[model samples]
Target: MKLIKYCLILALFSPLAARAQQPAAPAAQAPIVLRPGDMQVQARSAANRPDRAPVYPGGEQALGLFFLEHIKYPEAARVKQLSGMVVVTATVNVDGSVSNPQVTQSLSPECDAEARRVVSLLTGWQPAMRRSRPLAVLIQLPVPFGTAGHMTVDQARRQPQR
Candidate 1:
């Protein structure tokens, strides 16, 4: 009986002794912080090299037409003499909806607001594709605001932008 007790005690303590003999895991390191530009660069690369880029329901020409019809060179932007393009970075969701629209380049507050509004209004975009499945992709769009941009959507639709 004495031998059995000692053997059992040794068996139980053997594992503990082994564990104590091993070194402890190294202390966990702090997580790396991602800069704002890092995400933009990564997103741009992914969007540009996608298996298939997101498309408007009708295609590239349709996208051009869509912007033409929906974008209304804001009156405030016009009055403020705001020209040039407002570049908006957006995520075309897997369900063909836009989310996370952000002004990457500022033309003016009015122009930026107008650009966001137009992006918000857009729906049913064909989502990006990879391996025959839909994906979310970051895309940058330029909305022009000026007399130089004036044109009827119908006319523009007839002659799609290249």
Candidate 2:
């Protein structure tokens, strides 16, 4: 009877003992930060070539038309025609998704807002890739707003010291 009781007790505690014997999972690891020098070294080691042309979603003219048609031009701004370029920095993900679209340079607030709006609305493009993987590319778009011969900010600023 004692042997049977001991067996039952052992059976009951066997699972618990087994669980306890197993090693505990290691603690979560912290992310690593790469310094500028490390990044430079990594870049140098990477097999990136300048000769290859970057892939864009569509032709420049088509893209420009898309921007022109879709973008909301600022109507409130006194000057309608904003005549410079918008430098957009976009991160093209592996899945061909455009993330972190930002305006690096702008000529005017109206132009900037329009460019930002267009860029934000842009969907996943066929990202330029090296070795069949997507890569981030900087796209500079020269957006010329055709308005009645309006004075530019620079022109206004440089108005013969009136």
Candidate 3:
């Protein structure tokens, strides 16, 4: 009976002991394969010109002023002293209209909603241009909400990333 017990204990622990004694296998390295034309540079064409980004109707200052006028501080944020920038991402359509505004960085629910509302209300955006053709683009607008004072676009831009 004692021999049987010892055999059972050995059987249970022998595999673990063997695994612990073995060194870890080295990682296999993948071979680098290169095909023809991999390093060849293509000639630049007029159609390959860099895309022009979308512009606001009144530019940055005017857009900032519009936000100052329209964005109302949320009572919840004010009560909680929640002061931070909410990053709102949206698509500027080929027609220069804003669409699909969403909160990418949220400070609070109330502040997020307010930021989305102000962004959606924006208009007169100049669509991006590629080779003189209008193109839609994604844009990130930072909206700041604070209880201390009204936040400006410059101030919002200066906020440290969380």
Candidate 4:
């Protein structure tokens, strides 16, 4: 018993054991150094690339205005005082048409349906281009319901739920 006790004491107090108990120091990371032209290889001339993202007919502001003008706040959501963004996903075909619009994130059943309706009505979308060739791409749009920015207080009050 004494021998076992002595072995245990020795093992617990050993220098190697004490070192193992301590947290290890983190290794130093070398700073990344880039030469003046290190990034030039990855960049291509804009004229040659011609890669572009899809654009709405009028632009971002116009798109937002379109939504604000068209979105009908659901009566169910208005009664509940619900305010949130419903993400609607759709594909922009090569011919500038929207297809397969679906609600990716749901705020409410009524709000989701309303969002889909608005998104379905969208038109005149310039399709994305890669190497100067038009490409079909999926796009997600956030439809706001009963939100302060989207549905103005006056608008909500004036157009009470029917």
Question: What tens digits encode model 4's per-residue C-alpha lDDT throughout 35-105?
Answer: 88784433655543326778999898898888899999989899999988899999888899898999999
Candidate 3 regions exceeding 4 Å error are: 1-50, 147-162
Which candidate ranks first by TM-score, i.e. highest?
A: 4
TM-score of each: 0.58, 0.50, 0.61, 0.62
lDDT of 2 at 74: 68
> Residue-wise lDDT of candidate 1 within 1-162, one digit each (tens)?
999999999999999999999999989998878887764334435434567789888876776677778887778877777768789999998999998899999988878988899987779988888768898889898777675455555575586342
Instruction: Please rank every candidate by TM-score, starting with the best.
Output: 4, 3, 1, 2
lDDT of 2 at 145: 51
Cα shift from native, residue 60, model 4 (Å): 1.2
- At residue 56, give the lDDT of candidate 1: 83
**Collision count for each candidate, in order:** 0, 0, 0, 0
- The pairs that clash in candidate 1 are none
Q: What does the lDDT read for residue 29 in candidate 1?
A: 92
Residue range 1-162, candidate 3, lDDT tens digits: 999999999999999999999998887878756678674333663563326789998898788788889989988887888887889999998888999999999988899999999999988898888878888788999886763235335556786433
lDDT scores of the candidates, listed in order: 0.81, 0.62, 0.83, 0.83
